[model samples]
Target: MTATGAGQAYGIEALNVWCGLARLTAADLFAGRGLDPERLDNLMMSERSIGLPIEDPVTNAVNAARPLIEALPPEERARIELVVTSTESGVDYSKSLTSYVHKYLGLNRHCRLIEVKQACFGATAAVQTAVGYLASGISPGAKALVIATDVAVVDEKAEYSEPAAGHGAAAMLLSDRPRVLAMDLGAFGNYSYETLDSARPSPRFDIADVDRSLFAYLDCLKNAYADYAARVTDVDFTRDFDHLVMHTPFAGLVKAGHRKMMREQGVTGPRIDEDFARRVAPSLIYPGAVGNLCSGSVYLALASLLDSGVVTAPSRVGLFSYGSGCSSEFFSGIVDEQSAATVAEQGIGKRLEARARITFDEYLAVLEHNLECLVPVENRTVDPAEWEPLLDRVGDRPEILTFTGVKDYHRQYAWR
Candidate 1:
């Protein structure tokens, strides 16, 4: 199908997110951990998706992409020549996560399968890479699937990072049908440097320097946009785009980033507040509800904006993505009137509501096994029955991809 809006050719065709079936309210988490309640407002999170022992990055990727793949006609699905999985939660050193995802998704064997790692920015990088390939005439009328998947590894020891780190995946289809966001090809910018602001040094441990990460994030936001403005002409931070979306580690940082940008453009006082309300606030709802989705964060932000009922017209949108270790990009796209409704039809809100909310004690029960999900093992098995408390919450939902066990170092999975 030819995309009907925003100078179409290549962009997101369909989108979906899968966050497993468990969730925990940040307020409850704060209370249980003895974290100061007053500081909760700074993170602006309501709840976060919890990764259970039966769920991992692989399960997350497959679950997110299954619906999108299942919805396509045979011809369209067959044309999906690339599958790129971006993640910080890889299960193996040599075998890319895309291999397992590709197996479960049952894509055409002729397709290319790959994985990416640049921390939270990996998904954006995956999106751009897919776009580049589709745009390249190397394959005519082709399609690609990009999934940003991750699992939460932090606990109370990681402190605030524990609540802010969410688990799930965002899957998107890219083709000539730019019905969602018609990416402004070539109008992009980049910034990067070696910094240990945050790092997952092991499958079971995460180290973060709050001060360093904060400074790096804010610093990258400024330089990345500056690079974009330097490359693209006739752009105004305040006047050019109808909305703004950014990689939201926490919703408050988005507020801070937008405020910084507005100030750079001499947009002060009430105008900044007014502009933010109209453009940015709509994007924060999902991020706040789900915490940071890692590489999936920005896409969730986009979904929040589209489903927020603020999109009544085709409008330009500015997007920024930053990853720790650190890479950043500033880019944009256009979304027409049809985009919002298309997203709404996906029932994102309904799915979010369906997630089972568990208590702090239940969270504690699953914590140990959850972190062991990625540790390499030659022989191991995960009993779904052990995860019944969390799984029972979404038991009514049919056909969920699950991790069963491993045989001879190869991971095994099944649909429950």
Candidate 2:
């Protein structure tokens, strides 16, 4: 039987994040690389998720989602009729990452699996698509799994991008339950245009125009919010939304975006800071710790808010998602105490704290192989034992999905 009821409600029923097993403290990385100390404060980040050779998009997606899927009852699991994966770090041009993720997550065979690519905007697109699917009367009780997974490809040469880039996935279950976030359906704003702000020309590398990217991000936020204001009724940027979450490439950018919005509202002096401290600071906690989760940034921020213990009562959350080359949307959702309780149950903060903190040198050593995650290789293999020392540092060594190797131009994975 369909788990969804006739009473109309649909959005993210459950949500979880996996930012990998290790992190490099941003301050240490900056110091080791001889970067400016003031910039570290400007970045406003503590660590960046360190991608390992033993992990890839497949593993990350599986690990991020396994907990939710395994905890699902059989009938409910079967209701997971769709899986949409969003990524810019794709492993193959011909094959979608959803195949491996869906298989590894042990979802029902009868399911719709697809992938969406839009830089940081992909997650929102996938979430909206899933919500729409479930809201469609044809699939009255269906649930969709939306996963945004990626591997970091930056190094010291990437300058600031290196320290701000993160590797991982965020899994969201969309159904009529909407336990975590009850979306304000039909309330959304959009903006997009052709601009070479940033892109990955090859699986091996990425190119970006820092200035252009920054300007585009701010522009998108402003216009998108204006578009949203036009569409939604009685919208007050500072008053309507109890909290605000934006696609964060870095925590500092979010602060800047908030400032732009406040300035638009003629907000000045300490009230802007007061509003940010109250409505925006909670969402930055996770992004500051794990860097950017690419398309998952906004969702991670939402998770941060949920885990922030702020939703004592029902709260309205304004969400903004932007991707470069460049598309954006401003949307709204409702969160309650249940949202806080469910996200807290995931213990995201504790898990992040538990990651093995690697030094800059150690981070360098691992990047050589981790960077190969998206490369098209005919025959390659990875041994978990090769990285046991790092895992040893992990202490608990939870069994996460691991990338074994590639054989016959195909990727292989296992639990370890």
- Highest TM-score, which number? 2
TM-score of each: 0.97, 0.97
Worst 10 residues of 2 by lDDT: 1-10
TM-score of 2: 0.97
Model 1 residue 346 distance off true place after TM-score fit, in angstroms? 2.0
Clashing pairs in 1: none
The TM-score, computed over Cα atoms with residue i paired to residue i, of candidate 1 is 0.97
**How much does each candidate deviate from the true structure in C-alpha RMSD?**
2.7, 3.1
Tens-place lDDT per residue, model 2, 1-416, is 11122358789989999988999999888888888888888888988888788999999899999888987899999999889999999888878999999888888899988888999999899898888878887977889999999988876668878889988999998888999999888788899998999999888778889999999999999999888878777788878899999999998999999998899899999999999999999999999999989999999999999998887999889999999999999998889999999888788888898889898889989988877778998999899899988988874667888999999998998888
User: Global lDDT of each model?
Assistant: 0.89, 0.89
What's the lDDT for residue 414 in model 2?
85
Clashes of each: 0, 0
